[model samples]
Target: MTKEISFIDLGLSEEILNALNDLGFTKPSPIQAECIPLLLEGNDVLGMAQTGSGKTAAFSIPFLMNIDVNLKAPQLLVLAPTRELAIQVADACAEYSKYVKGVKVLALYGGQRYDVQLRALKQGPQIVVGTPGRLLDHLNRKTLDLSNLKGLVLDEADEMLRMGFIDDVESIMATIPEEHQTALFSATMPAPIRRITKRFMHNPKEVQIKGTKQTAPDIDQSYWLVRGMRKNEAIVRFLEAEDFDAAIIFVRTKTATLEVAEVLEKHGYSCAALNGDMTQQLREQTLDRLRNGRLDILIATDVAARGLDVERISLVINYDITLDSESYVHRIGRTGRAGRAGRAILFVDSRERRLLKNIEQTIKKPIPEVALPSKELLEKRRLAKFTQQVQQQLESADLEQYQTLLEQIQAESGTDLETIATALLRLAQRDRPLILPPDPVFKPAREYRDRDGRNGERRLRGDNRESPKRRERRDVGEMDMYRIEIGKENGVEVRHIVGAIANEADISSRYIGNIKLYETYSTVELPKGMPKDILKHFERVRVLNQPMKMSLVAGKSSEGKRGRKSNQPESDDKGFAKKRGRPTAPKF
Candidate 1:
């Protein structure tokens, strides 16, 4: 079909229709159109669509329209498994509520002050979205008054079941007025979840959508197997290493979203942060800038970014691997919208091998592993970007002031025009390094000899060089140098370093270089010309309060260093499930 479908045909209000038009929603997905009309008639919907299938709007529009913003008590309630999901559902409600006056959308989750949520609750929001734990807490404390609740939505119900929050969800539903309508959306209706639907929902209209479907098929997906130590640096390196008109980098947490957005903005990324904490006004303003092409890289948590169908998002970077197949599809869905071609990248950890299997199985396609952008490619991309910028300046710039300076510099310095232009080029490429910088954390070159006539292969001073029967198994192939700041002085052991890096940066202990602990620093062997951003962050990253500044030493050192090749876990995990049944940690 040439078109997906439109929400207007579903009979949304003129105000909502205008808002949708403003948001550029050309048509509703099959799920939205089918569910919206039924819900507006106050039907209890049992929506079963693949993740990223526009289910948020299916429930949100009807929920928003029914709320009497004038009556402040919570009228509609949605329970999510994770803090992030809770926040995101609330955000979608907020967006839809923009036209509906006086009704406030509040998100309740932990990891922050409860007083803040309580204060907002006292202000009388028309709708409440919350994780089960926090919602239960508020319910027990009497901060959340759901006596007037007319609608209850159970989002990611399968995940809540997996996380053992079904009891809370059932309890919450029980507490709500039995006469009210209820809608439950789950990727799969497991036995436990189905029980709730049977018990609570009255003559619910079921919408079941299946398949290990990639949500936005128009989007092209790629990934960089970056060493975990320096993820932010890797991000920065890759930004210079590629060309994107606009991108939205997805991180799992509000802290990460804000932190990465800040770093990108600082380094000239035209980026902004979208999270639950930002005001409704500021959120709208940021989206406005993004739509107008004034911003790139809107770093966001999944919850804060729901219904963010920005056609301008040319790239989607999964800074963290999503917890579920559905979220993976949903986050990437933000791009490639409206039949536009989009690009998406997922950052995976080698330890989560199980996740790779799950994702591949879930998507029913093999997502090939790709190497990080090489230093040479980064330089090329940077140079090309720099040239394009220069051309733009040449076309639009006011030249009189620069022309006088060019003429004066030519006379005084006696420099050729090429030389002057080269100087300008250098200036442009200075802040954003066109080349990857060498890291200090990796091991020294093994083939090379120390000034003392000892080969870099020789062990440290305390080691018994002549000792036989070494228990440690050395790889048969060549080894490379990789540096780290952790050492004996830092109370670090080989195993600790291995475990931490494996978990945090996705670096396998097998590929790790020779670790020589020093009083102030230590080094190991790693593959050459490493992605500088990942390397730099690893160099300064703290392993037990002492920063493990991981980097590749310039030259090769030992055996077993052939670069580079690219999981665990239980569960058939089949039968169409949502990404991250619970909220925060689904993304690795």
Candidate 2:
């Protein structure tokens, strides 16, 4: 049996080793250990690994290290399949280059200023990482120089082949100096990629890493069911309560990383932005600050955050669903590394649940479902964290100096011990209001009406729904009462209940009377003695699929006329059964 070697023994600079230490990485991943040495010798290489197998770093590190910064032109180039993937590949290069000095990494794709890319190109990046079309566009315009190219990397080669980039890749490869080292990495080797690799280079080293596409095992995974409209706010609330040392929030695009980060910052989070648009220097600074705790949350596109590992990152949040299982594993792998336990919380909407199932099957484990943090729970969590901060600082305070001041304050105010402590705690929380704004009124929860056509849950009814300006609750005058299993937000219609009773109970619509909708359940009026048989069938009748158990509304209604009512069931937490919504835009 042979022993595995470590990354430090692989001839990386001490700085790279140190950065790896800070990133909580010790040994090179199999592909990295295998591919790096060969590629460093300036040989063309063919790599076969699954998605998320650390392919980006395998090719990027070699390409980045071999570049000539003195040339003041692109010495190495990487072509990615999509705009997001391009940005991600560029970000990976920039991250790996942080310890490698003077290596400028630039990303070019659609949706940004072309002139900006031109300017950066003119400024002389040591490496250009871009999508095929954009890279070719620059090559044609003569804005990008391939004269000094020393390396070329085709990342996700099969994906590019699938996207019809094989022809473009061939053309771009033709433009680069034939002497340049070529590296192609893909999860699958299609006929075209194999053909491309065969034609593009001399004998190439091939290293296939096992489980490269497999999800990291250290991450603790869970999910929450949420509606489309509630997702953003729910995510914000989760961030509020979560005890993240430093979190990386993955979105889909360079643009989304910025936009979402902007929203988080506006909400008073200590956050920083990372994307392909950032210069290599700025990208390093942002990462450095995060490592040093100058930043608490990092918002980034997956491309922008590739090859990024922060030891302090105890949490990984997938704000938007990635399109593939490979990307899903990659995003959440940012946390729970290096013998540390990590938590990955995925916010899933109705449409994205299918992705969740797909991930579960791929991972071969069932990820548990969790509920959104309730408003009250979020407040309690915030307060507890705030108090802990104060306690930690209080234990470290200079007692002699502050104690003297405190004595004087006690003497002057004649303050009791409890009074003084209360005052101090109050002062600590004054600026930091633990009380969050009231959560929006959610509709009542439904767990299906029973056989008797009654809801199993009680609706948390009235005085909660947001109105133009909430009106004062009127005292109740009871009318003959009836039951509705559906509550507000269930698409409950007075007419639906009226029609159900009018038809099933053989009761007139006029006698059906007034209706009220609550958080979990609704109530309506019914005429007395509508027929025992009719009532029996009526109890089993579903109004909007909710049981129509005849009973007086729980809350008092206008004019005390409580005919008769019985308990149906308490409503579920509001909004549990709202109709499914559309697919959400992946957090880029």
List, residue by residue over 343-393, the lDDT tens digit for candidate 1: 888887543333454566666667776656666787777777777987898
Give model 1's TM-score versus the native structure: 0.48
- The weakest ten consecutive residues by lDDT in model 1 span 579-588
Instruction: Estimate, for each residue in 209-321, the C-alpha lDDT of model 2 and write its tens digit.
Output: 65524746667899876532244456687887787788988776565676678778878889987877799999999999999999989988766787998898989888876
Instruction: Show model 2 residue runs off by greater than 4 Å.
Output: 1-3, 212-220, 223-435, 438-588
Off by over 4 Å in 1: 1-5, 212-220, 223-377, 380-588
Cα RMSD, model 1: 18.5
Measured with C-alpha atoms, the lDDT of residue 568 in candidate 2 is: 33
TM-score of each: 0.48, 0.47
